[model samples]
Target: MSTDQSQGGGFPAQQQEPPGLTEEMRPQPDHGEKSYVGHGRLEGQVALVTGGDSGIGRAVAIAYAREGADVAFTYLPEEEPDAEETANLVRNAGRTPLPMALDLCDRAACDRAVEQTVEGLGALDILVNNAGYQMARDHSLEELDDERIDRTFKTNLYALLWLSRAAVPHLRKRPGCIINNTSIQAYEPSTTLLDYAATKAAINNFTVNLAAQVGQDGIRVNAVAPGPIWTPLQPATQEPEKIEKFGDDTPLGRAGQPAEVAPAFVFLASPADASYVSGTVLGVTGGKPVF
Candidate 1:
């Protein structure tokens, strides 16, 4: 609520196992619940946001519903409680919310998610590839094991590919759009986020290339590259010491809330607002450059 840039100036030192929960957060991250007034920007749309259980995905799902879209979203099976809460938020917005528990690393599951959205929601208008994985082992290349690398790549990159491919046919029918969730880490690489950052970079390339390929069909593709926004990912992925100083280095000097980032996704999804906007990476960072 205060743009003073002092809120969450530095987080209280905390940690959580991977895939943290919102209720477990110290100062819970905002998901634009009481805020974010809508103006029918995405009216009549049907959106599928991966990882809609919490964080940026949750915020986007809520915003989309408020903007008049029936929404379907995915989350890890273990995150069902969080997923239910997100679905409730969507329902509060007077839109249908289909919450599915999924393991994105499973390629077949990714395909099934797209299929379920199409079948359940009636039509697909926006696809937000927002689910991702990151862990800060702070390990050297030698210590970063193959298993972790595989999981990171599979979750962040492979799932995007699988889901997008499956959704393309449906997207083509509605001349829909695809919005990928990338990160500033793609440009400013962090050694600890080696695999994650690499996948984000690949996502950027994929977004632009896909836009070009789909433009003639009236389908737009783009990405949102967020900086150190406050999300479950931070507590779960960053070292505890890093968490205390999270987002302090940003020009804004505080971590952004999920509410702060949802507008970007809203803008990119609304054809009225961004019909000509394709092959673009909208940076919602707190003054971090994604270039």
Candidate 2:
């Protein structure tokens, strides 16, 4: 019930409209623009990261490009500004960047995204299902509306299936991988985020099953379960007061930054690093047990 005090932990009260902009955050998130270094672990590869305009997705795009992989990332319409910035960062790494503006709730959009990545970048080596939607206004199911619940399911779950299904064929050819973004909420549910937590738990199940289904194709499927990360999503979706005390309950007593979660995605996508790693949900939480 209380936030433990950490030297660099805690956020100030802030608020933003839906689909928040990174520039509007009080203490801007660190997406490894300057800190991440490449070692050519993913040379000549192409990656598709959903929700890559900002947050963990942007960090992964930056890291993937630095690692010598061309990246095609997706964003909502309102996120063009952030998407442009992400694309430029990828370019700065001397790798091609394809920034796709999409509404993943549409099945056609999901297929086209994968199609464009292969058509645009030549091949698809990694697919990151990182786009997620959640709202904090509902305290109970009685308070939850159909529109909000449907949007949550469609954005977090349906789009994952649509994108992965379309990408699997391309992934099979290159022996590529899929890295889904799950959350600690999968294990520890919050009353306000019941729908989001539900979808995340389903993602854990899907990751493991999909890995089993495609292991024969030499394709690995895994997920990253991050705890409280300092991303634009926080201020956009959470109550301002709650934002100030975020991540205090973690064993580390601090929230993680987007930069901190990118390496996990890179590790999973790298063939040499994760040749035998599949069906596993890797925890990037601050000592939170994903199990």
Candidate 3:
């Protein structure tokens, strides 16, 4: 079995896997499989996490489970094994893991995901909007394709709005919370990820506005803006050369692990840790500037 560090990058020539999840992925992502210590921060709550099969989503799911919340997660059908692994980790942490496969880019699918999560887990006390996609390009503004821009916006922004809208009814009943996965690039835009960065900025705005709108209903909404973290999206979307140097140049001098960022979700979900917190964006970008 390959250790976590060995699975970083550089797979064998014979291994060919899909973009989302592959059995041959080296150092398979650490989904809190064997390591994740919990402290019961979220006992008796329910959480729904999009893209919860791997990366930060997986980490959050496991952490939520360990912290005493049953979790419902979404992933593509093609990533069944990885999704199952996440569910299993949640089970090991003593929480039920309801894993569903759905394409969140569709409004109907987003609604269904929220519905199914509520049906399976009883009620949703927390929502983690963590699914996203990005492709790097060094093109000028004039060269950017309209389709790519639209797709990025649809996946990163529109789906979030749709899902949040659908879940608000249930959230209102229980006085729940939402935590969006924004990116550090929202503040420090990358030349290659223009559209992606724009969507993240929009996410920030949406989170703040939603928090204010729902505060009267007792629903807290916040966001987590992570900087450079080692996740599958890096290798799936970037060039191999760029992959090799992932997270090396961050202010922290290294990319953060998903485990390191998952705690923020736990903190925001629990009223004990964040009773007065709402409409705020917690910066977890390895010491990056917020402005």
Per-model TM-score versus the true fold? 0.97, 0.97, 0.91
Query: All candidates' lDDT scores?
Result: 0.90, 0.93, 0.83
Model 3 residue 169 CA deviation in Å: 1.0
lDDT, candidate 1, 1-291, per-residue tens: 222334856798888888998888888888888887888999999999999999999999989999999999999988888999999999999999999988999999998899999889899999999999988856678877899989999999999999999999999999999999999999988888888889999999999999999899999999999998889888888888898899888887888889988999999999999989999999988888888
Task: Write one digit per residue (lDDT tens) for candidate 3, span 1-291.
Answer: 111433332332222233456345554556555667778889999999999988899999988998899999999887788898888889988899999999887899999999998898899899899999787734567767887777788889998999999999999999899999999998999888988999999999999999989999999999999988767776666666665666666666666778778888888999898988999999988678766
The digit string of per-residue lDDT tens for model 2 on 112-142 reads 9999999999999999999999888558889
Can you tell me which runs of candidate 3 are displaced by over 4 Å?
Answer: 1-18
Rank by lDDT, highest first. 2, 1, 3
Please state every model's RMSD to the true fold in angstroms: 1.3, 3.2, 3.4
**Reference-based lDDT, residue 258, model 2:** 90
Error of model 2, residue 272, in angstroms: 0.3
Model 3 global lDDT (CA atoms, 0 to 1): 0.83
Please report, as a residue range, the 10-residue window in candidate 1 with the lowest summed lDDT. Answer: 1-10
Task: Note the residue pairs that clash in candidate 1.
Answer: none
User: How well does candidate 3 score on lDDT at residue 239?
Assistant: 65
